[model samples]
Structures are given as structure tokens and as C-alpha cells.
Target: MSRRYCLVGNSHLAAPKLAWEGVRAEYPAVRAQFYGATRKQLGELEVKNGAFGAHLRPTSKKVSRAVKRVSGGSDKLKPGSFDAVILFSLGFNFHQAEAIYRTHRTLDFNGSATAEHLVSADCFRAALRSLLEDSLAVKLVRQIRQISDVTIMLSLQPYPSEAILKDGWKGWTTLKAEGDVGLLQETYISAAADIAEAERFDVIYQPVDTLNSEGFTKQDFCENARRLDLAAGDVHPVKNYTHMNADYGERVLQQLFAADAP
Candidate 1:
């Protein structure tokens, strides 16, 4: 019996065509699918590439809407549908806001308010609390629990690399100065903990923090002295970084399927 997997999220969650191609090579027996909003095309397997690109920060309203779309569109799936669903989101909003503030020294909307002034620890927590209440999280949690024999995995995006940060130093520095770094980490850790405690689902924490252990700090990832266009100095992780995520996914699937065995 072949296993089924579905991935849902924003453009950041969208694996480059090469990543999926690599997945196919590694897991020839498993059927993979994608549901997101990216220009890249999946050559085969099933896909619902309708998700829009946005910053999926801790308290994003878009997360709820995207989850709702997934639940409501369940009927579109084949009779048996998905055995496992992977959600890859929640980091964009914080990073984007940081980037904006760093460059302009002000908010994208109100130049008067700087990014440093806008994102406080309290504000980050409040936004995250609101985001967790959105319909999508509720729906997905309900669906996962209600549906028999389905596994739901909520995985966090890898922390931004120093290589990436180097590419966008000004914005990154402003964000750090505003103390958003600690706030962002706290939000993700707290949210993931809350979700895991509340639900019987699996929460896989990538070894993103370990990157720093390996001497790859934010500076290394963010700096773009290489001046390469491919290295778009933004919060989004580069495709190469996906290797860690993909490995995490593979290990997770193996555990889920092994446990499912009769």
C-alpha cells in the first residue's frame, strides 16, 4: 500500500521544483502532493497550487484562511484522500516587517512608526494568540482529530541563515535592534508547545537552532557580499536549506507509517 502525503502553506512552503524531484528520487514508493501558491509546477503526482504568497508569521490571519480552504476542499480529494498533511508556514510576517523597517527606518504603511517601535514582545504574543484562534487552525485540528487514522504534522520553518541575513544587513540589524529576534523565537516555541499540548498531533522541531551551533549565525546567512541575485536577502530560507526540512519530513513520515503498520 503506497502512502499519501499532502503539503499545504504559502510560497515559502512551496518547495522548489528540484526539491520535489529529489523527494521523488528518495521515496519512489511514496506518492507526494503539494498545495501552495508558487509559480513552480509539479511535473506529476497531485497538487493544489492555489495558496497565496504572504508572510506566515506567528499570528497571521492568513494561516486560518489557508487551513479553512484545505478543510473545505477535502471533498475534492480521492475517496481515501490524504493519510498525512504537512503544514509549512509561520515566520514571514515577522521577517517581512523586520525587513521593511530595516530598509526604510519606518513601517511600510506609516513612515512615522519605525519597525523597532512597532514589534514588541507583547505585540508578538498578542498576534500569535489571535492567529491560533483563526478558523483554519481550529478546522485543521478538528479535522485531524475527527478523521480516523490521519496524521497532522505542524513543522516550523528553519531559522533564517546568516548567509541570508548578510544579503539584507540594514533591515536585519534594525529588526534585531528592535528586539524582534527574541520575540520571534519565543512566539514560535510557545505556539508550537501550545499546539502540541492541545492536540494529539506530532510537532517536529527542525535542528534550525543547530545551524548557529555550526557557526552559521544570522550574519552568515543574511550577508550577501557575494551579491548573488539567487540570494534574495529576505527572511525566506534558501532552497538549499530545505534539505534539513526534507530530511525532517522523511523521518516524520517513516515514524508515522511505521506506527500505522498492522
Candidate 2:
């Protein structure tokens, strides 16, 4: 019998969904389901009898649509119903990462010891703690833990796609990406793992082969990614923020499966 898995998240669930559609045939004995809503509607999830269920009707059509978009709107996940529950790219992704990028200067914990490095580590730990304790990520995990005893995986969102590295993106975050993006990514993942472990959940990081030298996702994996180029006006046009194609998502799913295996 195939093992059924429930994956829950926001828009970031796009990659995993895309990948599964393209590669489900390869893993004949594994089935996956998804439950997603816009970030704002996440709090709308209701806990019932120790299981997470989507309410019959949500306040907005968009949230209602999101609930049905992945797995039909009524697939209530109960404890031990599936082999795994993977939370993809929620909570401590860019919101927490960008904070460090803007503050920490060239201080690498992976490098030789230095006072500056220690300070950076300290600052990063505090930020990580805040995100885990106060951010939506932890709250969601808390909800899931109460409802399910299956293996839980908290996967951080992928780093800014290569599109952010292009000249078209004039955002301040892109500037920070150019300098020490790898270190920033590492800091985010390390801190996330620390808190995830404390909660008895597993953490997943991006595979090295998918990353470029600076730690941004490689362009090949970001086929649909878009960015705004220089225009006559200082206006930065809205570009598609897609960061993963089916291939990349497939890689992520494969990794998650590998970790799920004994």
C-alpha cells in the first residue's frame, strides 16, 4: 500500500506541488496531499478533536479557493493518518532571513573564530528564537503536533531565486543578496534547524547542487522566475516571483523522501 502524506503551506507550496505532479509516477507507493491557504488565512485553521480541519466556509473567496486548490477542501488530517506531514517553506523563510542579511556584516560562524563572528551568531540566535517562538511557523507546528504524531518536517523556504541576483531587481534585499548571501542562508538554516530540533521536528535545507557559489538558487531550477529591468522611471515593475520549476520541486520531494526512509 502507498503511504499517504499531507503537505501544508502557503504560496510557497507551489514548488512541491509542481514537482509531485511531474514525478509521482517514479514513486508508485507514495501518495501526497496538500492543504494551503493565503498567509493571512492560516490562522483560520481550526483544531478539532486533535486533528486539523478546514472549516466549511471561509470569510473570503480567495481563502476558500486556496483551501480547495490542493487537496479538496475537506480532507481532514488526523493523527497517524499518513507516513509524514511536511510543512513546506512557511514561517521562518525570508521574513526572518532578510533581517539578518540587513544587520549581520561578513561574520561567518562556519569560518575561523572572531569576536565579530560571535556577535553575529548571538544576534542570529536571538532572531531565530523570536521567529520560532513568536512567528506563525511555531504556532502552526504547535497545532500539528497536537493533532498528529507522524514524523513532522519543517522545510524552510528556498533562498531568493537567481532572479533576485539579476540587475532587473532593484530591491534592497537583492543588494544584500549580492554580498554574503551564502552565509546569510546558512545562518537562517542553522537557526531554523536548532529550533525545529527543540520542537522534535526535522528540518530540511536546500541541496548544495541546486545552489550557486553565493548560495542563491541556480537559474536552471528557476525557469519561471522573473525580475524587473531598468526603466525610464525609477518604478520597479512587478515581476513573477516564481522560484522553482518542476525539476527543483522534484529534487526537494526526493530529499524529503530520503529523510523519511529508514
Q: Which structure among the candidates has the greatest TM-score?
A: 2
Tens digits of per-residue lDDT for model 2, 1-262: 6677888776667677767788889989998878766566765665565224421234556565557755665435453667877887666575565554444544553322322234556766786678656666567777777766678787777766666647465443454535555566666667777788777788877777787776667777777522111111222233434456567778889998887875
Collision count for each candidate, in order: 21, 0
Off by over 4 Å in 1: 38-75, 78-80, 90-126, 132-149, 167-171, 174-187, 213-262
Per-model C-alpha lDDT, please?
0.43, 0.64
How does model 2 fare in lDDT?
Answer: 0.64
Which candidate leads the pack in lDDT? 2
Instruction: State residue 234's C-alpha deviation in candidate 2, in Å.
Output: 27
Which digits, one per residue and each the tens of the lDDT, describe model 1 over residues 135-198? 2433344444543345766555545555444455665545554655554455556756665577
TM-score result, candidate 1 = 0.49
* TM-score for each model: 0.49, 0.78
Quote the positional error of residue 103 for candidate 2 in Å: 3.7
